[model samples]
Target: MKHLSDNEKDTSRIAAALAEDLQPGNVLLLHGTLGMGKTVFARALIRALTGRPDIDVPSPTFTLVQTYDGLICPIYHYDLYRIEHPEEIFELGWDDALADGITIVEWPDRLGSYKPRLSLDITLSNADNDPNKREILIETNA
Candidate 1:
């Protein structure tokens, strides 16, 4: 599905809607360049799943991964941008997250061969050069 978000609020709404369909063992691959609102969507989705609209969902840039206890299951948010190699993901509990939790990965391209074959791919981009507008595309390969 394709969506045009006129502002951050719209983006968050879209993420919240998507969050309702998520389940354990589900992987979400977030694709976008710097400042493309990947983190914004992620934060909103995490909040929706946790039933904490005001929760602090920090980007896992430095830490590599952040875990949250969702309403239905665990949520694992990963930022692989700084990883030296995809093999390093194993040390971050990638397998465990995929086995029992919902995983949201930013910079999933860094996963290389470790990237899951089945996942929901969400791509975000600037819309018409508008800083507040975003073009989002969601695709599933399940």
Candidate 2:
């Protein structure tokens, strides 16, 4: 499915709607350029999943992974942009997280040959008419 968002709030709403369809052990692979609002959408989805508007979802750029505890199921947010090798992901406990709960990964291309089947793929692109506008495409493999 395709979705267009006019602003951050719209993006969050779209993410929240998508969040309702997610289940435990699901993998969400997000692909987009820098500043394309991938992390923004992720934070919104995390909030929606936990039903906590005040929860702060930090970008896992440096930490590689961040875990959120208040949700019904554990949420593992991973940012592989800084990873130099796929082996580094194994060190970060990738397989264990996948076996746990929901996993939202950004820059999954960094995984190289280690591609896991994903429940959904979300790709974001810049809108031609507006800088703040984002064109998002969401597809479910299942």
What RMSD does each model have against the real structure? 0.6, 1.1
72-132 per-residue lDDT for model 2 (tens digits):
6888889999999988988887887788788899998998888686668999999877999
Candidate 2 minimal-lDDT segment of 10 residues: 67-76
Positional deviation of residue 41's Cα in model 2 after best superposition, in angstroms: 0.7
Tally clashes: model 1: 0
Candidate 1 residue-wise lDDT, 65-128, digit = tens: 9999999989999999999999999999898999999999999999999899999999999898
What TM-scores do the predictions have? 0.98, 0.95
lDDT of 2: 0.88
The model with the greatest lDDT is 1
Instruction: Please give the lDDT score for candidate 1.
Output: 0.96
- The candidate that wins on TM-score is 1
